[model samples]
Target: MQEYSSQAAYDRGEAVCVIGAGAAGLIAVKNLRENGFEVDCYERDTVLGGLWNPENQHSPLYPHTHLVTSRSQTEIPDFPMPDDWPDYPSAAQMLDYLKRYAAHFGLAEHIWYGSEISHIEPVEGSRFEIVVKPAAGSAARRLRYGAVIIATGHHWVPNLPSYPGQDGFRGTILHSSQLKDGSRLRGKTVLVVGGGNSGIDIACEAAVNAAECVHSVRRGYWYLPKYLGGEPADYALARLQRRPRWLRGFLTDRLLKGHRELSARMGMEAPDHKHTDEEPIRNGRYLEHVGDGSIQHRGEVTRFDGGEVAFTDGTTVRPDVVVLATGYKPKIGCCPPGLLGVDGDSPYPKLLARMFSPRVETLAVAGLVEPGVGALPIFHWQTHAIAHWLHIRKGDPERAANFRQQVVSESAQYAVDSTGVSPRHHLAVDAEEYLAGLGRIIDTLEQEPAK
Candidate 1:
């Protein structure tokens, strides 16, 4: 790795440094600024939309990508997306929405595009010294700030899987991010791997575009249409969450009965966990493709030989191209592992309340969890709490001390404690439970300190 010399660290006293200009980072800056903090946001990409912008070289958007969650549920709380837009909007529209948000809040002036925070070090007084590396090979600059909020998000690092003889396989294999053009699948026998939203969506795409489409799944997954019960699926489900616990399950099952029966008839594995455990597959077209025999559902890929790909069930297919939609690994590369409570060799941060750093009071990570719903709203609330807490901490030491304990207790309240879950599921949170916790934390911060 090449090393660059960093200039003398310039101190921006009492200011906050926010990494990444993604939706989360933008929200963090807006909230911090609203709380009267001097916030400087850094974006590695030239644009401010983060992964939503296809122009971003590292964007994970595949062809025809759209919001898996509905517009109402996905929009930021304070700044809702256009009311005239469809229930689910396209990736381009999402980028536009984010850009609009930045413009509306005047967040662009606080953002430094083409600047990445290569590293963040804890200096004296609980402040952070951040190295800003420019994309154009300029010398790195160092700056100090009173606090830092990491909102880089976790979608950039592709979690690619290796198969036996994959190195020598003759077929072209690409991660979903690399499959930028749908024309690449045209007239080719395609295999779509993994069972996440990406995988399912790509399979449906290939079902329509490819000569033959084979979808490889490792286990059972819930296939949810974009809509259910005459409303956007996520919105409907979220509404169900407000009902009594006993009735919620019965109502949910009824709503999802058609999907479950269809998946079973198609020989799909039943998901081992509840529907809410992870973000379910949200494309309505995937199963329709399967029913029409446009998508051949197969077990996990066992090996690749010459041009033949073998599944665990011993079936083989010679695909011209393979798309691996196996999602991303949660990685915070800019900060030291210890600062985020990452155990040895683990990339995921063990955050308090899924935002605050367990080890550093002045540091927090936003939009790191998979809330199984619209993520922007969650980011809004998380950053809202963080900004409010920072404000309280600056004024009332007694209240700050009490609020820290409240956050720790709040974290435990909604934890999805279970064994044998995947690392991806580690970030999963029940959105309803988490939002309530965030609300409580905000309420605590807003309450006046005892006289």
Candidate 2:
């Protein structure tokens, strides 16, 4: 449990500090470390594998969790899934895979677990100070890094919405981020609100274990299969031989649009969420819940009285525990209250195209976005691009302007998806977008870094 000796010299090159030892951070660190940068990874959790590890601190997120995304596409590059393993590896297995990745690539020595980075501020000029709080007896420490990558993937903070009785409720209420397993909810009636993947998973878990389960959604969503012909749906879509790229986009949109049209006809809610509606994530398993009947759909939580949760349809239901499978708020520390120009009223952390803080420079956030492809790949792509631009190639004035413009253009092009939908992009759409982004990063690195 020893620490690396602190250096006094500023010319010791850059310490590329990455936050969140999750999938994205691990990938970023592995690549940056291999690229010969002095990399330090920070994770608040004792164990690695942010989403893969199951802990009570996280409840229902643990048990019965099989990855919906295929093992092949989900794994890190150069690391293939074992043939003997199931198509969709369980959370425990994914954790094992991550452990293997760390060992195989010798990333364990570079990572500092249970260490939470509190802030990344411009100390004086281009240099940045990364302040972190060690998990235990160690006092706070600071490292001066020339560049920092906020690969602290988006899902850590729970995006829960406040409801009427949330405060005075006698029952326990928490978000999916707080969900670890179904142990505590044993025999207790649980109410899961939201229609995302987490909401569906929690409802299924509750149905199997809880006394009674109810799920409410403000609108309906389109559900797609995780795989087609034994390959991931996303992978299959990419390899579609019969269609051209334009046709694929057209056909993809048509298929999604068709599902929405059909859902509306069947007395079920359609793809139209609120106009200001939080767009449904690109996912599998929405209609499956209705078919399974695990979740009794209440319209929406109109209000609540002590033990009863009233719905928008004027019906009332009382439950022992109310779990807001609602989304997570971005975990930005004590910073100024500001908003984005794109979405003026929203907070500052909501970046455009996952970069361009619009105010902060030498500080770039890479993983707050959601792409159709998956956070696994998109986050790495973002970190790869942001880290390269900020650390490895910071010197060129013209290139920096171009980088900023590209980010702005990318944000505008994807603005509909970002501003209209949730911050994350659908995985199917994101795969290609991020791959292109990564390619651009590779191209940009040829110039000299800002000294």
Highest TM-score among the candidates is held by which one?
Answer: 1
Q: Rate the local accuracy (lDDT) of all candidates.
A: 0.91, 0.63
Q: Go through the candidates in order and give the clash count of each.
A: 0, 26
For 37-137, candidate 1 gives per-residue lDDT tens digits of 99999999998888899999999999999999999999998888889999999999999999999998899999899998889989996899988889898
The regions of model 1 sitting more than 4 angstroms off are 1-7, 417-423
TM-score of every candidate: 0.97, 0.81
Per-residue lDDT tens digits for candidate 2, residues 1-451, read 1342364423324777777777777887877775667888888888777767775134235456777666665666557668799867787887788888888888878888888876556666656676677879576676777666666554656666777766777778877766666786789888888877677778778877888888887766655556544567655655553588678767656545654554565445666532112323333454555556665777779777888888888887788988888765455552233422234545435565655466556566655654444355565566666656654445565777766766666654443342234433331234455466556655766545455
- Model 2 — TM-score against the truth? 0.81
